[model samples]
Target: MSKLMIDSFRGFRSFELRCPGHVVLSGVPRAGRSDVISALARVLLPESRTSPTMSDLWQTTITAAATGDTEPGKDEESSDGQPPAAAQRLSSVEPRPYANVEVTLTDLDPELEQLFEGFLERCGPDGCAVAEDQALPGAPWCVRLAYRLVYDSDVEALEQFVYYPLASNPTAGKYTRVPASTRRVLPVVMLSAGRPLQLRAGSPLRRVIDELDPAAAAAAFDVLRSRVTHAAEELAGHDAVAQAVGVALASGGVGACLTDTPLDTAQVGFRADDGSAEALLKSLQPTVNLDAAGPLALASHGSTAAAMLGVAEAIMLATAPGAVILADDFGDQVDTANAEHLAARLRASAGQLWLSTRRPEVARAFDPEELVRLTRHGGERTWHRLKRPADRGRIRAMRQLHTQLLPALTSPAVAITEGPHDLVVYGTVDRQRLPGAAPLSAAGVRLVAAGTGQDGGIGEIPVVADLARSLGFRVIALIDRDKAEEQTIKQIEASCDVVVRLPSRTAIEGAVLAGVDIAKVRAASATLTAFLSQDPADGVPDVKVVEVVKRSLHKKSLHEPFLDALVEETKTPPPMIVDVLNHVAAAASPSYSGPAVIDIPPIPLPSAASPS
Candidate 1:
């Protein structure tokens, strides 16, 4: 088992993808999901000379930005006074373009360590351009950067390099190539998105088998072909497949087993031809009989069956326990049941598995903590891992609401409220004031109503915020100041990108009542005087005002007449509402400047000189 860390590789800037066990990578399209898999494969099997689909040169240019002067012997200080002198000098010099891939071996057995040592000794920093002057003084051996591959286009070749940071001198050492012995220890099988399901001579299954054991290649095909033959023969006795194959044979058609050009590498498939003796042995292509009329490729049955068969072979052939299985868009072709079955089989078979998909059905098959989210911002990419000790019960509940809450996963910003009523209240106010500017939906901000906590308390904001952050969303929690403990509020603020508390030190309803004009309350509800009469005239407690509004809005839901009155009567939006809108706007924008401070003096409640 090994963990792969890639920095400035292809579409990634700096991200660590842990491959300790089974992992499922998911994100929106073109967010660099597939790139991660390809990069990992390249790192593990660098000698294979494999490149990704996008051949636009996976390289980044390094240029040193201007920095402040420092002591002659000391490192240069950048504007931030943080980046190392080598990095600062690199930024100041003419931009040098290169790509890097590094793999950190973990849980290595004695045999594997011996292989690593041999490879390390073979590849030393011979051709590397040493930056002795720019190197930092007394840097820890484990903290220095190491390189695996550097592309020098001038020579049009990939220059292999290995930097042993544990050594006294840390510099990239060059090598002719990575030892085949080293690569043999780590087996990586990648099921690309564009992989063909048809069992042809050059299919993905054949490629994997050939890579793993070229000697057993002949026997591996024999086993696979035998399985398909038995399956087809068994199906011949069944209802649907039997009927179809029988009809084709009865209509002057010959049953021919699909075989490759080379007799040694043959797979089980069906081919139908007119009852000609010459066609049986000379059939160039093999097709399976799916319908009564004729024959078609095995893929014609459906991608699900073909994909499952291919994956099964890949898993079987990846005999080594530490071997990795990488599948991009793992279950896109299969139904939920089959996808779940495949996920379980993959987990049980391999030491490590990496899967990428966009389907929620596929994502739900694995544990939430095993899911990694890849998010792209501008030119940089980041990977986010969900926290462990995830509430499986809550996850199941969330699965039920998957369709309704899916938009939140892809939204630019998500605001988690305490309950449904809070969502309705805040959502209604934002919609009323800013028509066609619905923050929850139109502005790409999702408002989630996380219900009460386990202890029946009203603060589920932190839990929901953590989930949102793990899924790579910019999260904001809207919590009541009074209901949440100070520590809980602080935790939510720290976990979430933003936390907006209601100004009245209570719920959103309190903020509305405190901000709305007293005249408007009287105008909206004719029975307002009765509720206020119980409190002192100098200053009415927020609880009394909340009670009045809750009772008045009870008959009609909170979104109806009451919210309408609050919107119409209030001269300006409440502070919480304003803050939410500001956050939404900032999230929607490509470049967020900063949080805007809207200072609207708290509306004065009617005092003794009140209108009675």
Candidate 2:
């Protein structure tokens, strides 16, 4: 198997993808899943210089100091303290926006050698000045390129070049045009989200045919044509598809044929006597059917057929045996069963299949290690490979819940609370008081309950934090100060980007009690007491106040009415709750700096007769 490593490539800061097996990439939309796939294609097939429509080349402006130059000389400085002509020109050298892509081929073959020879020749001492020094040694069987873009003003041209890094030199290396021969070694087949499995020119079907054995493909087409012709002749019933065309026009009316268009390429199309059949026949382009409502072209069939066709063609065109197959949102249009079946087929095929999807069902079909997640935080993109947990069976048992519980894994930042009650409390306060501010989801942050304390104490905190970090999420473990132990807190703080403990020996319930006004608490307690047919006690302790409110609002859920009443009556959250919310918002916000030590005043111990 070959391993591909990409650094500072488009949205990817650093990542590695191994080939020759099924790998699923998933994340929230616009998290750079497709960009990685396109990067792989560009690396393997260096002839492709332009970026895919879904992504663009990553560009960055470089200051002169970054390129090993000091500030402009005083002689070159203008009287206004501006840089001199020469200083201004050299003040900021763009260094040509670039990305680094490297591939390690385990077993070298003649074809690969030929490809490497061409690549090395372009990067040799005679070519780009940096190529020879930056070229990889033979032992590793690796090819590395610093792909950079240069603009030429005289010619009004912009071009891309691949440079080899020098061993000790940081600023210069050999460079050359992207090697054109790498395409012959490994072909990349990419299926984007919007790409349909149509049988038109430049469509996936056409590309598949072009890659397969011409004679075999032609033979298959003839057989399919004959089958369709036979089926059209037997359409006697008043079926929707047949009735739309009145009668079957001819025996060969539904023949599968190729048309030579002005572009000088053969386009696959089905021939039908009546034009009405065109829509029906086009829908089933992968099959030899004249009926629009046939099993192949049904509403449910379109997605499945499209997915299957791409896989089928990939299997047939195993020209580059271990070719890299990239599909963005692989099963977006297919049902769960069909998507899983397609995934299984790809797993059993010859090439390495990389698929990206947002569907949990599709993600569940693969093992933890086979899944790669992308996340963006603070304007930086990171990739994570899921690792198999020691408690694999426990994870499997909770698979359904885990899938629903961890929406935070897809978000850029996550707030890991102790349990659902805490989640609801904090979430309620955030929504009610800071509605106009950056909400969790709007800021690309998600609040995840890390399982209740009854489940396993705080053990799940480290586990969940590690999992979130592995997927590149900036995590803030909001723990109850009372429940946190010194060692456990230390471990969680080490694993997460931020660790925020609720104010002194208090949980969210305590924080709410300390934050909301006494009058609002009494009113909410009164409302609950009336509903529960209980008398309200005077001078109840803060702890008792929280317990009464909790029980009264059980039927209605605690967060909303209780928090709402607090906000409405008090006009603001208490200091403690506000402090906790501030920490959560900061951690979730993209502008968050780093972990901080927060000081929160201790909640005074409850008086006698306080509820436990």
Candidate 3:
């Protein structure tokens, strides 16, 4: 899927979202993520019951309907050859604006490109055009399909259809409906919340049945259905069932004859499941029984989800060429480890995969470039895609995005720390300051470690800052007052909105340890030593106690316990230390006027400029 365009559809008045195949959408609740999934279903999957209702019509206004009292023009002819509704009402009704949802599909395999040859058009900087027109030569070709719902004045109801909208401005063009036969080539499967893979009707079994020779399957079904029905008939004809049914229906005074034409006969009998042979295939359910344990269902959700994914893959979706699978609230039911495992497998199963989730781990399963951030404010929705070059997650250098810094996708502001130790200290201080509220997380702030000034840790701040800003987040950099290089500090300043430095010339260790009483320091040191299972020596030298505290600060494994003890022993936090936390914590605003992150255009297709 190359692009999705929406206008006057659902909650979106006008929107455009373009991303490469296999995306992970993350956003706050009620941010229209589900609406996007619904839009895709309406256009691509006929099985989806997204029929347009009155509520689906979004552009009608009370004033427009009332003032259209004078608009009973000749264009008010009925859709058929009948009289229009406007001819009867005292005041004319204004036509509702058209609701259009269009999807542009590219990256077609060789066979599909041939199948949709007539519909293909090259889209480029000047816009889309056929080769004969010579307007879009050398541009990449794509096929655009859409669902349009329009209000019909004659019928006084909404009408909708999915069609090949083959025109530069899709709203114009002939109404060429995409027939059911052709739609099989572009099948869409929806996997949403509370819906795990099952073996019942509409499952993979049904799809496999449909793929078999239709006449052969129908013929076999006819014989099996007749045998089942005949057996049911025999049971009803038994002396017991007929007598019971007759007594149940017959009045006390009347004989058991039910029909006037037939003598001493009843009309009721058992009715087996009845439908066309083809339709019966859809009602068939497959069951699995393992050992003595009967199949109530798959043993667990993980097994069921995994089984379904395997079946979907077994169908060979890549062979279908244009199959699209949408997983809304993806991995909501699975555990973190399993969800990540499922995420990777899910991407490989289909030609295009679209997943949305509130869970951070599921989103992290894909590369950061595949992550799309969606936000809604003041009844408007926008989508943001990362602007980095198309690495497709191969470069493992950005591992922080896969772990500690993952929350930045949701945070409105982030405090980029110089090392892992700084995170624990700053995080503890933020928690202490907000005693009445939740920590930085509750306020939508993230404290991310840039690294320990080794292995591309501190130097990664500029990259991380750029990424956070690309997702519409504010960046605040926290570095040691003395240890950072002049060039490294300047690079961070250029990318981040705020840069905070400690007062001491040393790292956070010296800055946090300043102006503390010696006895209190020794007490904190004993807390660390006792926790480490070391025997206590009576009256250890004061200089040696300081050395123990400094050594613990350098090693990450020892920082947590010592820091917790120090925070507890020292009643008063240093004022300079508190100021650094203040700068990082200032990012959270209860009511946010969103940044212009939506202005980031989608990444263009390789060697092909975006169409106008």
Candidate 4:
């Protein structure tokens, strides 16, 4: 069975945030994106907390609120003694008839605000402060802005419970707070891009928190003050984490490229540099609960980095292990690099991070293993989950196309040589030099030979080798057998893969004469030498056949001038020259089977190519 499988679950009828970490829901505006976010908020927050006017009562109350007839934050009495609120509080309650998603805003981190601000600027309409005008048609930009601004501020209050150590102080009207445990939280703040932010810190949430923990209530304001500094420092770094956020904020949509602006690593050390570092460490951030009103929160304004950090603060506080954050239209303002990094980071830090986005760049950035794609069919939501192997295959295919076909299609592969003769040698011997078993013409692999026969020209071999490797090719070195030493072999091997040294010390002249009959030359030399010098008593040659041939070739005209030219030029016998040619001869020999090892004469190394 294949290691990859596509899984689709259809039980969820509308939109739902069944888990938590950081879920971003993004798609073409008005594709029920905001509706999904709203649905998620419905799931996470209690119906009591939701504005009643925006719920089942929506049909009757929406018209009134739109016309400013219904009072904002107006409440009714409930049996539980809590005020009956709007079924959903989007900008203080009113039903919006657009698509969106619901999400959480928790644990605000001020340090990452600047980075998040960049993200917002990138997503901002006409590139300015988030205003209601920026929300696209069918999405309530104004209400979303105000609603989340209020909601995020309330959520930020939650962190005070953890950050400050508590002590009872009856005379002070509140408890004294000191430093507590250095809790590492991955905050996920919900935000909307390009809209006014008008959240008041003194919203009912403050009262509610005070009712829960009066001691924490007094320290809440101080926490917010500290977070502002934290956000400032994170804005000052150059690191991958900050860069990822910056990339997301500097674009029109969530998927964009990583650019040169780096995260400032100096300001926010990875380890807790101080309480100050703690303030700036908003690692995983995203905008959630997006709709027209989503962008009203101050946390949602400014750079993409600032906005994403806001989201990160919310997620860190809201999630636990095995929680699934299903963010529909989650990456509406995310850049490609940031989206990818955020997705991978969330998956690593949390149980499951499910996001909905329609950007192809986002789809491309995601690993096939981690992607869960959603589409609307017959008014119902449908999705496909990709497994690891399928994702891996997709990535591999992309890499192959990028490295190989793109270059060839753009420009022909050029093989630059020192001179025309080098080109000739490359053209003539290339086939023999590069065998089909060792093909080198797909993407990054190219071959260049220096046929000029100049010793100084050989210096380019290393450069060519590097170029080939960079282009993804294995280069094989070929040189003449001119009294080569072991160091020559090592140097060539160090630069390239396979090295083929030419047979017969005469260089190219010998190979041309031998042609395809190199075996004949070997056999004839062996026979003549055995005939000319045989042991009188034994009537047999004591030396190996190849050794006798080498000695004969040395004595002949091919030896002196060829050896002198090659050895004096490069200063070393090209290692493996005779070895490769002999192997070739043996392969073509009648007695050949598989890889036959041919015995050849051992030649002394020349003093030239040796290390100084």
- Least accurate 10 contiguous residues by lDDT in model 2: 261-270
What lDDT is reached at residue 493 by model 4?
Answer: 56
Residue-level lDDT of model 4, residues 408-513, one tens digit each, is 2111132333323333433334334344323233222233453224332444445444443333233455555444565654665576544455543634333332
Q: Write model 2 residue lDDT over 1-612, tens digit each, in one string.
A: 356677666666677766435688887567787776766666555545674321243555555422233454446556798765544534432323445665544344566655656443222222222344465553334344444444445664555555444221224534554346545445566654443556544455656665567788657656766777656555533255554443333234432222332221122223455434233335453433435655453234555655566666665554556665677777777787877777666656646677787766666666767777877655666667765556884474244235423444456777777766777887786677665455657767677777653553455667677777767777788887766778888887887887787765676667777645455677656644434556343466655765665444534455556676667666776567667767676666667776554446666532334344
By summed lDDT, the worst window of 10 consecutive residues in model 3 runs over 596-605
lDDT of 3 by residue, 206-288 (tens): 45654767577556667977776788688878888888766766656255354465323245656544544445444443444
Pairwise TM-score winner, candidates 2 and 3: 3
Judging by lDDT against the true structure, name the best candidate.
3
Error of 1 at 467 (Å): 5.7
lDDT of 1 by residue, 169-190 (tens): 3234433445445564566666
Candidate 2, which segments miss by more than 4 Å at Cα?
7-21, 26-32, 43-60, 64-100, 105-188, 194-197, 206-323, 329-351, 358-361, 374-382, 386-406, 515-519, 522-544, 550-578, 589-595, 601-612
Ranking by lDDT: 3, 2, 1, 4
**Arranged by TM-score, best first:** 3, 2, 1, 4
lDDT of all predictions:
0.57, 0.59, 0.64, 0.37
lDDT of 4: 0.37
Assess candidate 3 and give its TM-score to the true structure: 0.72
List TM-scores for all candidates, in order.
0.56, 0.62, 0.72, 0.26
| Candidate 3 overall lDDT versus native | 0.64
